[model samples]
Target: MPSEIAPAGLRERKKEETRRLLLEGAAHLFKERGFEGTTVADIAAYANVSVRTFFRYFESKEALLLPDGVEIFAYVEHALSERPADEAPLDAVCNALLAAAKPFSASTLTALSHPLEDIENVITARLVQAFSDFEERLTVLVQRRLPPDTPDADLKAAVIACAALSAVRAVLRTRRARRASGISDTGPAPLLRAFGILHEIGSPERP
Candidate 1:
């Protein structure tokens, strides 16, 4: 049993390593050459793998930026579920977005942003569809946390989820702009600030 399992485990590890290499290679090339300038062959050569191997891991060059959604959705769900029961729905969602972002490094986030900025064709359409799915899922999750008798419960959930997601989008756009300006930003400070502005928008005016 151990012998059989060992080979299987080793194969899985190799597959994961190859996947990582492809992702890293794609990122590096995308950064250096821009998304439209970088081809699958380029990425494959960067990773020292055949182009066929690249196709085995990803459908196209665009896919390197657009990862599978299942894992991220699960992470967001778990983070949302773990938020304090007493927290406001929007606050919980914002915190969960922050938590969901914790796993990505600055370079990874920047790489993801490249496709977002450069390719306004297939990738853009796919991103819009993906965000719509996320928005719908977040609304359902937020609604689950609300009081059963809450007024306009569905409307409220959709608003809260959309607002939280907008905050994240705002942060990513800022990061992308800053990167283009040769400035660097890291950590969640910008994201927190975006949420702070969101909260302020909902508050009464102060002197």
Candidate 2:
């Protein structure tokens, strides 16, 4: 007789396969038809799956493009928890931002190299959505990390989060401007400038 398989294990495996297929299909469709034009049914058809299966993995098309940001935020929170007690809150946040940006920056560069129209509706929109999701998460994470007696921890955290996001958007916008200007080698200057601005804002007692 064949061994009985666990229903939960099978369900999880099926979910993973469905997720992979949906993402792959969505990427292709977004590249081919532009993100705004690609419908859920189109993605489902491209993946050879039902429309319901597509919704099981992603709530909206914008999700497929930036699925990792939430996961990255969890990793960042974990990393922050391991920081030295003597480290300033801003310093800890800066470190986390740098680490988080490494992977995200690389992916954004790859996306930026693609046609502007392809990314405008798909990649950029997804990034904005991800940042919106991250803001609340970051606020909570910062509150937890700060001392219980700290005043206005949530507000300060919100400011820091906004500053960090602003930095990221500025960097990407600079890259877009460079491309628009027909300058091929804008180099790391734009990214460096973004970091500088973020650091200034994130520093304790911002000057």
Candidate 3:
């Protein structure tokens, strides 16, 4: 049994190492040739794997470049659920978004350091699509937090989730713009500011 388990574990590790090599190779080629310019063959050759092996791991070059949205979404959902029960609705969502953002930024999306302009555009478009997915899932999670008997509960959840997700998109867009302009600022400050604005919108009194 131990011998059988050892071989399986080694095989899994080798598969994971191959996947990582492909991602790292893709990142390097993307930086050198831009997203549109890079090809699957180029990545496979760089990783010293056959093109067929690359396909066994990733469906396309874009798949190699994009972060795993399902994994990130799960992370956000778990983080939101684990927040203190007494925490404010907005604050809970904010914390979850921030927690997810750190790993998101550290993923393949930013591994290129500074992706070319075209590559950045592709990433920005993909993220915008992901925002919609996050909003849909978050609405359900936010709804769970509200009293079941609350009036317009579904609408309230949808609005809150949408607003919170827009903040995530806002932060990404702002950072991308700043990076394009050669102004480097990578932190949670932008996200915090976006949520602060949301808080003011729901304030009881307007100045």
lDDT of each: 0.81, 0.68, 0.76
Candidates in order, TM-scores: namely 0.76, 0.61, 0.72
Candidate 1, clashing residue pairs? none
RMSD of each: 3.9, 6.2, 4.3
Off by over 4 Å in 1: 1-16, 24-56, 59-62, 68-70
Candidate 3 wrongly placed segments (more than 4 Å): 1-21, 27-39, 104-126, 204-207
| Candidate with better TM-score, 1 vs 2 | 1
Predicted structure 3: lDDT: 0.76
Q: Candidate 2 residues 118-152, lDDT tens each? A: 54545666565666887778777766767888888
Show how many residue pairs clash in every candidate, following the order shown.
0, 0, 0
Clashing pairs in 2: none
Choose 1 or 2, whichever is better by lDDT: 1
On the 0 to 100 scale, the lDDT of residue 129 in model 3 is: 62
Candidate 1 residue-wise lDDT, 1-207, digit = tens: 899999999999999898989878876776687778889999899888999999998988877777644456668888999999889998899898789778866654443344545444656676777778988999999999999999999999999999988787788788988877998887888889999999999885989
Determine which window of 10 residues in candidate 3 has minimal summed lDDT: 107-116
Model number with the top lDDT? 1
Cand. 3 TM to true fold? 0.72
